[model samples]
Structures are given as structure tokens and as C-alpha cells.
Target: MKYYLLALWMWSGIHLANAQQAAVKVLTRAQENRILVRWGVDQPLEWQRANNSGFILKRITIKRNDQLLASPEKKQLVRLPIKPEPVESWMNLVQQDHYAAIIAQAIYGESFEVEDTGEQSEVSRIVNMVDEMHQRHSFGLFAADMSFQGSIKAGWGYIDTEVVKGEEYIYQVAVANDASIASGAGIAGLNDFEPLPEVVDFMALPDDRKVMFSWGIIPYKGIYSSYMIERATDGRNFTAISKTPIVDINDKTGNASTAMYFADTLSNNDQKYQYRIYGISAFGERGAISKPISTQGVASVSTPPRIHDYEFKTDGSVLLFWEYPKDAEAEIQSFEVAVAAKDQGDYKIVGKQLTVSKREFSYSKLEASNYFKVYAVGENNQKIASQSVLVQPIDSVPPAIPQGFKGQIDSLGVVQLSWKANAESDLLGYRIIRGQDKDEDFIELYDKAYPQTHFTDTLSLKLSNKKVYYRIAAEDFRHNISDFSEVLIIDKPDVIPPSAPVFSNYELANSAVQLEWINSTSDDLNLTVIKRRKKEDVNWETIASFTDLTTVFWDRKVEKNQVYEYLVMARDEANLWSNPNNSQITIAVFDWSAVEVIKDLQALVDREKRVISLFWRSVAKGETIAKIEIYKNKKGEAPTLWKVIHAGQNALNDVDLDINTEYQYYFVPTLHSNTPAKAISLTVQY
Candidate 1:
């Protein structure tokens, strides 16, 4: 009988184990100091099908230190009222103590189902369509009203209880079927999860002798909490400035409708201030602070001084002067100077901060990009800046006055000046100056500064037999002129003279010697003088004088068989004489003797042959015969007309004389130049 009873009890325990919901989760509400319990079954449809009945909840508590309090014996059970809708807020419990443990239970039927309406209703069809669209199983309107009998399912649940401040508590929970069969118990202590709300919209505004701050309040959701304000000189790195948190009413109004205000007293008015506010919970938990805000105390601000004049040198030096307003509001403590290469480039400080009383500044040996600006600082530490100044260094020192100055004049009276180039990096140009005399003041040779070291004075064309002095000076890019260079004296050249006349040809006549010569080629020649001397004479006599262009000369006084020497000299307009250096031409004048009469002369004619022949002997001294003339005429006509036919020949033959006609021929011999010889006429018949 005992074995039978044990078997029956084991079967019932197995049945209860097969029909149970998941264990419940318990949470403590930090916003309300209340306990909230929630539980759900993993297979609600299967549980309803098996039990066909609703769940029952059970809760109980045990206080370890409060033994005088009546401890609940047999867990207090409460039947969950059947409702048409499923419950999300399974349970809510309030407890007086700030500390306690909670336990809970849920019992439900193993099988149950909602009664189905046995008709095709529009509401049912709509509900089914909605379920399909959502991809979820349809739950009947009366599904929560279903209950279970005999307790087919069982599972643990939870009840939240507030815990005493700084105290600890433990709790246990279990669930049983309608047959009183129980599951394992769950245990936990009260836990708080809610955190304090963050303070919103914290700000700092500048005010005289103080910095005012305001922030949005977070309505007390749990216990009464307060706000703590913090401050920092820099934007970051803050410390609590308000020793106590500013309190607010814990009423139901939202923090959005209210804002908390505070002022951090200032020891001085010259520094920047940053602020933030934090929400402190009643439990001493501090939420995150609001985002930081910064401000500067009120003070008069002024515009920076203006730079009125500035200069830059090629040697990397800068000079600057400025002017500032003298009004009382423009009071300035100091001035700051900075330089940069470009508009947006990082600027480096020029030097130590300067007093406002000093209106001028200078810098030297700066060798980078040159943009600059100055800032005026007020007593409140606020700064205003001036317009940027571009520092472009200019070359000031004139070049080492162009060394090695020299001038030259050409044969055409052109003056040329040359000198060494200036070594200055910024030398702009050179100037050439000229003076008529070495000691006189020089005038500019050119209308403008000469761009090169060499200068040709085109306007100094009258530089004949006169001295001209020249000097050079240099100017820099900034028009800094240098002193004149060493003097360069150039004397007009007199090197050119009339060219010597060349003897081209000579001819001797009876009473005179004819001479022809090439004219002197010098353009400046003034006159030509012809001189003559006999071989026996010791001195030369002037034969003729002619102008500079004359080329020919005549010497009418001459004797035969005499050797005479002749030469020509030329003079220029400068009174310079041509040096012959013994250059001269000599010639001998002579007369040729007359030729003698012809000897052994004969003439013959052949009528049938139509030929005629003549013969004669030449003069014994052939050198004395310059030429012979032969003349021919009709036998009777030529004797009167007497034309010469042949000369200097010993024989002559004439042919084709008219048939049966007689011809006469005259032969004459002439001396070299003096006279012709007697003529002989010959008659021939053919």
C-alpha cells in the first residue's frame, strides 16, 4: 500500500513539472521607491490548451532583523482576477521600509482555450487579416479569461519591496500547483537601477563683479535632489564652485518649465570663467554635468593702433610707427606685435609686450616672409588687432660707385664710356656725366639713367681737338644715388691726316712733262702741293698747288734729256701734314731723232696678175723710226691728194688696183714724236 501511494505521488509531480511557466523577474523602481514584479510563460498557447484555467499569484516577505513583526506562515496566496486583456504590469507592491527582500509566485492551468464563435463574422475576418499582416498568431478576445483546474502549471514570480537606506535584505520565492505541489524557490535582495537625471542647459553670462549662471532643473522623479555648479578658468578642467547644491521643489512639474540660477562671485574682473552644473540624487549619486560654457567679465574694449608709416630695407630691417586714439575709452595696457608670411599663416611674436606709450618699433635681421600686425591689449585682457602690414625690404645703399671708369673717342668723334658694374643687389641703373674741361661741372650725358655699364654719347659729336671728362654714378631700387666715380679724361684724337697722292701715269711732250696721280682719299684733306727738282738742282721748286680734291698737276718748265724728281704732299684742316717718308717718283724727259729717207725702193705692177709690188730699205737706226706711213691715190689723182700708204716697211705689194689703171703710193717715216719723214710716191699700172 505504501509503494502504491508513492507511485501515485510521483506521477502527480511529473504532471506538475510538465506544465510550468518561466521564473519571474523582480525590479525596484528608483523613481518611486516601489517594487515591480513581472512574469510570462514561454508556451502560453500550450499551457492554455492543457490547463484550460488562469494563473494564481503568491507573495511573501521575511525580515531577518525584525523578528518582533509577525512573519507570514503558509505563503499568502492571491487569485489573479480574470480580465479580457493580457496583463503587462503583473504586480506592483509598496513597502514602508527603505530596505526589504521580496518573493512571489505564479500558478496557472496546464490546458485552456478561448470559446470560439461558430460563425463567419466580419470582426473575426478583420482580426485574422490584421494578425496575418503583422506575422503573429491571433489571440482571441477572451484568451485571458481562460483558467485552469487542479493547477496543471506552476512557476516562480517576484514582488518588489523598498530597502532601508544603507541596509541589506534577502528574499526567496516559489510556486505550486492546485494540488499543492511546489517548484524550487528564487531569492534576491532589493536593487535600485534608476539614475539621477542630468542637469540641462547650463550657461555662464558675464556680469560686473560676478559671473551669472543658469540651468534647466530635472523634476525630482524619485527623492528630492539638488544641483551643484562648477567653474574653471580655462574651458576645460573644472572644480565645484557652489559648495552646496541648489535645491528645487519636488512637485510634479517637469524640469523643462523651470531653470535654476546662481552667481559665482569674482575676486577680479580681468579673467575668463567657465561653468557647468550637475544633478545630485537624494541617494548621493551624481549624474553627468551639463556641457560647459565660458565668459569674460565686462570691460571696455578698444580698437588696435594703426600703423601710419613703415619702411623695409634689403638688409632685412624694418621700421614702423603708429598712431592711436587719445580718447579716454581707448586706454590700453600694452601692445603685441606679430609677423606672418601669408594672410592665414601662423604668426610669431616679434618681441616682448610693449607699453602703449611707445608708438614706434623696429626689427632687424629678420629673414622670412614679411606680413605683420599689432594687437592692442586692454586692462580686461581683451585684444583688438590692426590691419596687416606687408614688410618689403628695399635696397638703400648705392653700389660701390662703378669702379674703373673710362672713356674713349672714335675717329668720327663719337664718345664711348665704359665702367665696371655695381655689385649691389638692388642697383637700379648707372648714369654717365660729361664735362668739357677736366675741372668743370659735368652734365648728364644721357636723358635718363643708363641701364648698362657702357654708354655711347651720340650727342658729343663735336669732340675734335677738345678734352672731355666722364664719370659714372649708381642708383639703388629706392633711388638712393651714390657719389660720382673717379674722373675719366678723354682727349679728342688727331691721328688722321690727308693720304699721300699716288703717281698714276707720266707722259713727256716737247715743252712739258704731263703727270697724272690719284687724289688723296682723306675726307679732311685741305690742299695738295706738287713739288719738282732737277737731278742737278739741290732744292725742289713748287710746281703747282690745288684744292683738297684736285688729282692732276702740270709742270710746264722742263728741259729735254734731264732727269727730274716729283712728289705730292697733302694737308688736313687740322693743320696736320702728311709725312711722305721719302716717297717720290722720278722721270727723264727726252726727244726722238727723225727718220732718214728710204733707200733701195722699187715698185712693180703686173697687169695680167692684177698685182703691184714695192720694195724699200728701212732706216739704219731702227730705234729712231717710230712709224712709217703709206699713202695711195689714183695715178694722177693721188699725186695731188698724196695719201700715205705704208711706213717702216722695206717692201710692199698692192693688188686689185683697177685694170689698165695707174696708182701712186706714198711712203713716209716718222720720228718717235717730233716729225714725220719725207714721203715717196710710187706709180703702178695693172
Candidate 2:
């Protein structure tokens, strides 16, 4: 009887509460995203009013339609609606005004509307949920006169009822600890039969990279069980990287399918792999899984040492050196060395087979004038060579190059000729000759000269157009001449850019507008990101700019529905904005849900100097009292922008004053918007 009465009270509250308020409203309004009953009130009722102060609205109650959904304290269900606001967030809420208001929600959520449930085994909890969703902000605990139990079948001492519902086992047993619960004034925690699973192979490594598993445990009896693999990249996200369990031992010995595996790669670059197993009896009972076993992967080097030096000594022996004071891979043997001089000189042999593991090397008698080099070789044979060091010995002179003489002359445009210089002082630089006409006898192109390398011509200038041609020759000094280089040419292109893109007018919605356009041309090399800003908008605006070659765009926000102007363009890698695609479109700007509340909807407000009045309305069934929050500030105290009016009661909506006085206001209906309860926000502005 106690439970029955409570159920009835809750039911009545749902059907009668909101219906009473719906009868008083006079205005019909729709917000851009909300539905309104009338000119939405802006001023929250003064909290001192009878409804908000000393008086408390009577707790509304309703009758339950069925025996289900009659629990008194369902913590889980209630916790859902009571969002877990952080302590600071909750404190901030209460501290905002004198106190925070608790707004009500729709009467039990809409009754369950579901498809047919065939005789097949299926549980229907929808009906139960709908009836229980009312005042969803809180959950209850007491199970009704009937057993509001979970799916578990038979228990240690519970008895089953008749008329079985498919696989569902209807069991009910009197509370053995009713006395214990009454004394504590709390519900009893569930107590079931014994034997939870036992840990078989439990083990954890010193590092946090630990794996948990169970094998050979009581609950797990080799009928082919399951396991998990957890890994951490930074040693923080210990994510379960495996979907299947590890297969360490086969149930059927040789017949066991290949076991899937898991390696938890840890931050230290070490991988700890664990294996565990579980099983279920043919009759449906389950055994504990065996404990887990862990193994680690081989250690590895994440970095290497820095080499800083290398030098050489005299005596034909090349010295090899390095700087790896901390290198653990030091058991290095045999030092290999090679030498070369000048950019064009071929590399020569110089290093000894071994350097007795010395950091410095000593080299002796050989071509003392040549450059020398030293490189270190690792056990793995990997090597690092030092920069070649050019050395001058006590006895050396410039190698010889046949000097004087040369050949040919021509004037493709200017002239052509040849010559030579000393072969080797470590032979470098070249010389070219030029003549006005064939065999005209020439002069050196460079007044200066060297050995080898000769010819040059004006063939390019004689070609006309934008093309310029020329040719080069190789020189080896000492009067040695090689073949000339291939002829060369360069040119400049002549092309132009295309026209600008064309865009459509702005389409309004919410606080933004939509804009679209056409690509500039066939070679629309790049689709520049779209840009926008309000008319007279100072800075360049960009709602969404994409670099990908996209021709279509939708600029989300334009200044409300007001007129906004925009230009569009395209550019190539050359960063050339195409001609501007211009458009001046005007859109309507209004908060639809912002109800234009008449000072006195139908009543009168008369004063000697002006008139101002209050309007009233009623709420509907299931509709909630959003905020009647009121706000007021002196003109100099606030910006022209919308400012929230805070100090007021939750139900207070209307405010009346002298019409000549400047005042701004609006109301926020509980309904954020007309879209849907869970959709768009509806604000009832006055």
C-alpha cells in the first residue's frame, strides 16, 4: 500500500502540472530555433514574491500506470540526470546569484513507443524506462511490490515463481536482513552465492608495464578461454591493444588453434608479453581463468655518440682518430684510411691496417705533398671518415703542364679561339680565346690565362629572338686541352592571367549566411580559400578557408541577417588573387523565438508622462519554467550588446516602467528552441 500510494502521487504530478499554466499565455511566437507561447518575459520574477520566497510550490505527484517503475531509490538511474558537475562548477553556479534554481524537466519522458516484441526471447525495458523517466533528474531505490530484479536466475536461497517468461527466471526471496537495513536507514547491498574466480598466475614486473591474466585458476578449466594485451607508447595510455586472448598453452594440446598473442610495448622500448586463459562449462557455468605469465623484449639503443676529432702524423703512416669517450661499442679494431687532394684528384691509399686503437695517427714517407685522411671502422664494419687534410711536405714543387699555344677562331656573333697555361701547381682555373671571324686570329676572352682549356664563341647573340647561346671548354693547365661543353640557351615566356570568379547572394540562417561560387577558369590553378566580413567590416574575414582545390563553399556566419558584402578570387603559386567576384546581399535579422512582448498584451498601462505595463502567460503540460532571470543596468554601466540580467526569481518574467526611460530586456523560455527537445536552443526574448 505504501508503494502503491507513492506511485499514484508521482503519476498525477505528470499530467496535471503543466496543463494548468498553458491556459494563461496570450502570445504565439517562434524563435529562430525555439517555439514560444507568447511575448517571452525577460525579467525573472523577484525572488521575494510569494511563489519564490516564503512559499514553496506544492510537490506535484501522479499515479503509476503499472506495477513497474515504482522503485524508491535507484542511484544508477538518478545519477544519470544529476550530471556530475565539478565541485568548482557547482560552487560557481550557486554563487552566481543568492542561490541557484532547480528547473524541472518534462513529465516522465514520452511514453515508450516501440515496435512489436515477438514471442522470441527478448526483454522489453522501454515501458519501464518511460514510466520511470519523470523527474528524471533523480533516481530511486525501492523495488516495487513485485521483484524489480536484474537478469540473474536462481540464487542461494531464493524461490522461483510460476509462468516462466522464456529464459527469464522470476525469483523472489524475503529480505533476510530487513532488520539490518532499517537500522541503517539504507537499502541492502546484493548478496549472492559464493566462489568468485581465483588468481592462478598473477605477477607484476618492477616497471609499470605490467600485464594481468589468469590461467590454471578454479574458474578457468581449459575449455578454450580468453585474455587481454595492454600496451603503453608513452607509459601512460596503457591501452588494451589486443582484441583476442593470448594462446600460451593449447586446450587440446596439439589440436589447439594457433594462439593469438599480445606484446605490451613499453616506453623504455621494452615489450612485456603476458598470457592468461579462461573457460565456460558446457552447462553454462564458468571457471576462473589462470594467472598470467610475462616476458620482456630485448633492450635497445635509442641513440649514438658524437665524433669530434681526427688528425694525422708524418712518416708515410696515416693517423686515425675519433671522439667517442662514452661509446660502449668501443672494442674497435683496424683503422682504415684513404687520401685525395683538390676537387678533381682521384682518391689514393694511405692508412695502415691497424692504429693500436689510437685517437691520433702518424703517417710517413710517400707522396708528402698529397692530402691524407683517416676513418674509424666498427666491429660491424660501419665506418666514419674524417675530413681530408691537405699536407705540404719538406720537398715538393708544382707539377708541370705544357704551356703556350692554342687554336681556332670564328664569329657566330662575337668570336672564337684557344690557348693554354702551366699544367700543375695543383692545376686549377681555365682560359678562353675569342676572335671576330673564322681564322681572324684571336685574343684571350679572359685577359688572364692558365694551361689547357681554350674556346669561346658569340653564336648565342647572333641567334636573335630572346634566346642567348654559348659554349664552354675544359682545361687541365700545362697546355692540355679537352673537348668543349655542350651549347647552352635560355628564354622568357609570354602569358597572361584569367578572369575573376562569380559568387551567389547570401542565404540567411541562425546567425550566419551561406555563399557559393564558380571556379575562375579551365586553368583555375588554385581555388583560394573563401573570405568574408560584415559590410564596413575592417579586417579581412575568413569563416573557413581550405587550401584543397575546392570550387564550392558555404560561409557560415555573416553579420546576423544584415546586409554583408564579400569578394572572391583565385590565385596560382604566383599568389595572384583573381578579379574580385562581388556580391551585396541583405538578409533578415531577427531572433524568431525572441517574442516581441507588448508592454501590456491586452491590458493597459497609463501614466501622466508615458505608459508601461506587465504581461502574463501560462505554461503547458510537460513544459518547464525555464529562467525568468531579470537584468537591469544604467546605460553607462553596460555595452550596447545584450547583457544578462541576473538578480531575480526563476518565475518572474514581466517588468513595467516609464516608457520614456531606456530599458532592455527578454525572457529565456525553458525550451532552448523549436527544433527538438535535444536539438536547437530556443530563447524567448522580449
Candidate 3:
């Protein structure tokens, strides 16, 4: 029986046992002379047992004159355990109170089961028996709660007429056979009873042939478990509209609802009605009634307007016609036409309010894209709108051609183009066309029309074309194309470097280096540059630049016997340099200082021996000499080293020679100094 009751409590979403741990739950209401106490068992089995075995009531004085009593005094309220009145004794009370009859039937009925037509399954039979028992237990408790007299008759209530003034007492109730007790405290004698607060924030909302009523529940949930609603056509006289008190069933479902609501249907529209509410406590006590709230029911506009036809005029205006039910027309107070620029955009009323007799309206203002709808506004201020219809003006003419089209290409091949925007109101955007040549067919640069006045494009620098062309055309909302604007020609950036100059010949004489080169063949060549650097130097210095077609340059700033590397490059108007590898040359300047060192050098030719003897003076003061070298060469030929002499020697003989040949002998001395040196030469005929 305990398990069955627990299952039933869980299924019904009742939190009686979980919220109150005691087997019996008690409540108390204080009065001037008497205190009313109510008690009930949380478990159905316990309640059934208590009903058979009766319950014991006890009281304790805890405080006097607001002062605590250190040792509480206890007393038994009844000498004998209190039990339910006999079934025969309830006959008179049952005739007076319906809830008393319900309690009587629940306790004294022969069988609590519903009459069954036919049943054979054991499971079905058991389930029906359980359901019947749960129904009896729940209905009996509910009935006892709704009637104070019923609770007393059921032995769940007590009236203490012996309460003392200015004293607080704690009451306890327990099943006669159980040790567990439920307790509650109340003050007696002192007027502790105050009027209950009226239903809070009570409101009524009138709708089409219906009214919804709601009131704050959280503020009064502890004071009232249910409510009774009353209504009246005239504000003076009111009567209960509900057959029974309305309980908030959502409390069992664990709904945290702040307000309780009740909806009532009206017999007719536009009729005034007044409503008020009364709160019913768990102890079957009705609280103070709420203030009356009044409103009138309004008729509903349910029929939507339907746009059957529309026409576009030559003046760029539109006319719309709609249909509505004749029977529903009486419910409508006015009509309206609405329009939006886009299909899903917010719509606004287009013209002044239209009467119910009007079925057509002319819309003078129009946009490129328009969605129109008709609405029927009822007397209740509710509006029902029709399906939106797309409307477009009749237009065959395109927008004017775009003008002032121009652009420039950067060195990175990025092109920026812009044009004057078309002034036409219906102009959607512009289309750009591009081509490598004026004669070839142009291709669209973008998949869709551009809505801006300016555009940018990147070109491949690897292409051979020097110039690209672009053209723009205006387009309207109806996809009409205008004539193409003037073709815009833009030059591609010059990224290719100029051809490098070639070194034709070079000479080393008079302690100076002279260089010659062939100029670059590119037509856009801007300058010819000459650069020179010592063979050991990491950086090159520019020595000369010529804007003209000059090919020869003499570098007189050179030192004797120094090896210098020269580069001749060409630069174009775009400031691009030529390749340095193809235009570089290395030369050694003549050592004129060596000629000063060996001013007295001489060479004698002996025709019989076929040899040339060379002599020179060495080492001046502050100069160190490493060795002397003899170089012999036939006239008009480059010299070759003949012999290396010791540092102490200043002369050498070249024996390998041809007779009658005008030979030149060079006397070069290797010096261990930072000063420049050159080889001195003398001509000898052998």
C-alpha cells in the first residue's frame, strides 16, 4: 500500500511527502478566543490507517506576554483519541455541504471501483483497482480541504476553545499508532487574525468574443491554494461563473508560473462585462474579494483581403484592387494599402485611411522593386493583411550612358578605373568591358554589374601587350543596357628592363682608363651609365652618365698599376637598370710611377748572340724592393716575363730573341709598398 501510494503521488506530481518530512502535516489559524487547527497525513496508507485508528492531539505553551518560557508546559487536548464521525451521523451535514457528502462517500462507500462492463485480464483488473483507490484517497482529501465542516467530520480538524490571552502555543498531531508527529505554532488571545490581502494585480484582457483574466499567484500562493472567479453583465450584481474553485494544476507539474490565468467566452461581441476574484485557502477559508475590472468584447477581423488585379500606368504609377467577404465587411472599420521596397522588408502604409466601401487605391509613389498588400482593419483595431503582390512599372528605356571614363595602371599592373554615375532613378549599376586591343571583342571583367562609380583591376605583367582598353555601359533595373561609353585606353606599366650596353674596346694609357660601349637598342633608353670599382672593392661608384648617344668615356681619376672593374649599363625612362653581367670589363691602368722610378733604364741588342740586355737603377731612400723582373716582347706584341732576378740585382739579360726583330724589353721591379708601380720599357733591335 505504501509503494502504491508513492507511485500514485509521483504520477500525480504531488510533492506532499518530499516538501513535508513528517507523516502528518499541520496548519493553524489564530483567533481572539479560539484557534483552529487542521492536520492531514502525507501518505495515503497512513491516512487510511489513521482514519481507522484515530489521531491524538496535544498542545504546549511556549511563550507568555511575548516572553519565552524556559520550560514549556504540555497538555493533552482530548482525553480520548479523536476519530471520524459515524456514517449515520454525517447525514444532516451531507445535506447542507456537497463537500461533506463527498467525504462521506469516500469513507463509507461499499466499493470505490467504477462499474466495469467486462474484464478478464489480471493486470487490467489490478490497475483498475489501484486507480479506484487513488481516486478515492485524492477526492477525499480534496473534499476535506474545501470544507472546514468536512475536515472536522473527518477527524482532521480541531477547535481549541481553551486558548489563553497573550499566550503562544505549539500544536502537534500524530496517528494513534505512529510515533511521528507534525507540529505548528500560533498565538492566541491577541487579535492575531488580520484580513487577508485581496487578489493582487488582477487584470482582464478583452479579445474577439472572449476575455482572458490573470492575477498574481506567487504573492498569495501560501495564503490561497485556489481561486473562485465571479462575473456580471452589470457592475452592481455579480455571481460565481465557475462550478468549483479553480486550482492551479501547473503547481503539480513544477511550473514556475508567476501568474494564474482563466479565459471566458462571451455570448456576443461589444458587450460590457465586469469580473472579480476570491482566494480560497487550504483550510476551506475564503479570503477578501478583489476589486472589479471591466471591459467590452470586440469583434474579430478574420477574413484577409485578397488582391485580385493590378495595373501599371504610363505615368509610372500603380493601381491596386482587392476583394473581401461582404459578410465580414461589417466587422471592418477601414482598409489600408501598404508597400515595401523589398519582398521581406518592413511595409508602410502608402496612402490615407480608406473606408470600408473603397476597394481600390492608386499608388503614385513607386520604387524599383515594390511589394504591395491590402489590409482590413476591424473595429477592434486588429488588422488582417493579404498576400503581398510584386508590382513593377512598365519601362523599356535604359539608363543614360556613363561618361568621363578614365583609368591608370600602376607599375604592379593594377588598373584603377572610374566614371560619372548615371542620373537615372532606375539605374541599377554599370558594366565594365576589357580587351587587349580595340579591334578584338571585349570580355566582361565581372560576372555581375558593379554598383559603384570606380573599379580596380590587376593585369598580368607577363603579357606582351603594352596597353589595355576598357569601356563601361549603364544598366537599368529592368535589365536594359545603354550604349557603351568612349573606349578608355590605358598603358601598361613598363616593368621590362632595357637591354644592357656592350663593351666594344678599352685602353690603358697615360695613367688613365678609357672605355667604349655600344648603346642599348631599346627605344625608351634614357641614360648611359659608367661605373668603376677597384678589383678588391665590394661596391662600385658611378663615374659618368650621358643622356645622349655618347659611347666613349675616359676615367682620368684612376691610379697607376691598379686593376679596376668597369660596368656600362643602360637605363630606360621607367628607371629600370640593365643586366650588369653582360656589360662588365676589367682593366689594369699603366704604371706611370714606375717610369719615374726607372728613368735611366736602357736596353742593348747584340745581333750575334741574339739576346737583349736590360739595366735599371733600384731602391731609392725609404723604398723597399723585393725583386726585379725582365719582360721581353716582339714589337707590336704583348710582353712575356723572361727572368726573375734577386732583390740585390738591378739588371737582367734576355737571351731568347730573334735577330732583326725590333724587340721591346720591360724592366719591372716588384716592390713591397702601398705606392703604385708600372713597368718601364725600352726598344731594342736584335
Model 3 misplaced regions, further than 4 Å: 1-22, 113-130, 180-191, 310-321, 324-330, 333-375, 381-686
Model 2 weakest 10-residue run by lDDT: 142-151
Order of all candidates by TM-score, from best down to worst? 3, 1, 2
Evaluate candidate 1 by giving its C-alpha RMSD to the native, one decimal.
Answer: 30.1
lDDT of 2 by residue, 299-374 (tens): 3222232334434444445443444444544544455656665434776656556553445545564353455555
lDDT of 3 by residue, 1-686 (tens): 01111111111212264544446767777755788887776666656777888888889888887788999889989878889999889888987877777677767776554333342234234446565556566667767667878889889888889877768888877778666534334334345766667986999877888888888898886678678999988897998876667777677556758888888888887678889999987678888998899887887788999999998777778889999888888988899899997779999998546988888999988877789999998764688999999998877888888988989888799999988888987788999999999999999998877999999999998775667999999988889999998889998888888888999998866778778899998778999999999999999899999999999998999987688999999999889898988899999775645423455787777777766677777645566666667777788988888777766776667777665688777777667773445667788777
Better of 1 and 2 by TM-score: 1
List candidate 2 stretches off by more than 4 Å.
1-266, 269-356, 362-396, 403-406, 409-426, 433-454, 459-686
Q: Is candidate 1 or candidate 3 better by TM-score?
A: 3
**What does candidate 1's lDDT look like per residue over 265-348, in tens digits?**
787778877777777543334677677777767654556778888876565678888777767335667888888766688888
Q: What TM value does model 2 have?
A: 0.21
After TM-score superposition, what is the CA distance of residue 455 in candidate 1 from its true location, in Å?
9.8
Order of all candidates by lDDT, from best down to worst? 3, 1, 2
